[model samples]
Target: MATLLHIDSSALPQGSASRDVTAVFRKTWEEQHPEGTVVYRDLAANPLPHISATALSVGSVDPAEFTAEQRAAHDLRVELAEELERADAVLIGTPMYNFTIPSSLKAWLDQVIIMGRTAGEKPSAAGTPVTVVASRGGSYAPGTPRESFEFVTTYLEKVLTGMLGLEVDFIVPELTLAATVPAMAELVGKSEASRAKADEEAVTKAKALVARLAG
Candidate 1:
């Protein structure tokens, strides 16, 4: 059975837009692949530390001559790398904060996107596959005025597709309800309707992709 890594980076519990959308995707994914296993990681609740200077320097020195700090860092990186390599699929819930991916999410990325492990220097190869489910509270799709202001989606696509060589898939639900006050009121009034619509759309796309993957 395939394993799916579900990563949630939002600090907000029930009210987080990213988590809310991710939940929808996860439910749909589980329904489609009842035999698949899921490993959930809540970065907000249990945050990962930033890479230390010791961690980087450890690679320069021989492992036999490494200090305690260097060994600890190496162990952490190894553990993180193993989790990523073992998973068949990854589902990341990311929100735009200050027009970029969340710091917690970035930290998680640092742990997983390791050199000579998750990616790097493989001659003959079929690349890995990764899917990201991004949620934001603004209209930033192409042709929209705020599209250029979006760094989150573009950066992720470049890193995952261009750098890591993963077949990247993304679901971006435009949360336009928060665009204006009256709209916000209406959104609160019919939040379930909005969520349901977004969920339906995401589920349809995700299921199709999964079927292709299984085939």
Candidate 2:
């Protein structure tokens, strides 16, 4: 049976744009693969420890020579990597935070991105498709003044594709704060439209992805 690794990192548990879209995608996926497995991780609720010297250094040393602390750290890293490697697909929901991904997601990346394993020439999870629901408070697409400041999709595309060799696709819901943020109040209509489109894409993409995998 297929397995999907679903991860959510939005700090806002409620009314999270990315989370909403990801939920739609996952629901569609579940409908298609009723017997499939889903491994879910709520990064904000249970944040992973950031990479430490011991964890990073353990990769370079011989496993037989690892100290007690280093061995423990290495084991955690191995577990995370193995979980990723076994996935048929991945789903990540992340709201743009400070123009980038949240610290929780970054910490998970650091822990899972070990050289010669998940990040090397022959990445263990290579060719796995990862769909990212990248929601943002404001428009930052090309031609926007803040385009250069947009880092969430660009960074993730590089890390998930370039480094990890995963196939990355994005469903962006921009201007997510229009309904609540005073500065973006005028864009409420646009935000709603964006969210609607994202939801539509989530369903379409999820169905198409499942079909492609089944093929």
Candidate 3:
């Protein structure tokens, strides 16, 4: 059976635009692949440990020479990397926090990105398709006032594709706080439009991914 590695890093689970859109994608994906497996991680609910000195040294350490602490940390890193290696596709739901990804998400990445495994020239999961739902509170696309602050997608695109060698696709829902933030009231319509487009794109992308996998 095919497997989907789904991760959600939003602290605000109920109202997060990224979570909502990822749910759409996952729902459509499961419908298309009824026998598929889903390995889910809710980072905000159960955050991963940041990479420690031991975890960072896992790739070079002689397994026979590991200390108890080092061995445990290395094992965790291997487990996380192996999960990625086993997946057919990856889905990430990340909301912008201070113009970048959440610390929880970063922690997960740290644990999983072991050199010679997930991040090297021959990344274990290289070429796996990954779709990211990146939700932002305000407009940060090119030509927008905050365009220069758009780090979430740009940074992820580089890291996922450049470093991990994953095939990356992004669905961004901008101006997510427009309806609730008083100063963004004028852009509520645009926010709604962006959300609608994101939801539609989520389904389309999920179907396309299924088709690609099947073919």
The lDDT per prediction is 0.73, 0.94, 0.93
Name the weakest run of 10 consecutive residues (lDDT summed) in model 2. 52-61
Q: State in Å the error of residue 192, model 1.
A: 7.4
Residue 178, candidate 3: C-alpha displacement in angstroms: 0.8
**Compared to the true structure, candidate 2 yields what TM-score?**
0.97
**Model 3 CA RMSD to the hidden true structure, in angstroms:** 0.9
Candidate 2, residues 1-215, lDDT tens digits: the string is 89999999999989999999999999999999998899999999999999898987787889999899999999999989999999999999999999999999999999999888899899999999999999999999999999999999999999999889999999999999899899888899999999999999999999998998888
Give the count of colliding residue pairs in each prediction.
0, 0, 0
lDDT of 1 by residue, 44-117 (tens): 99998887677766667898998888888888877777766676777888878877888998887776666665
- Model 3 stretches astray by more than 4 angstroms: none
Of the candidates shown, which would achieve the greatest lDDT relative to the real structure?
Answer: 2
The alpha-carbon root-mean-square deviation between model 2 and the true structure, to one decimal in Å, is 1.0
State candidate 1's TM-score: 0.85
Candidate 2 wrongly placed segments (more than 4 Å): none
Error of 2 at 54 (Å): 0.4
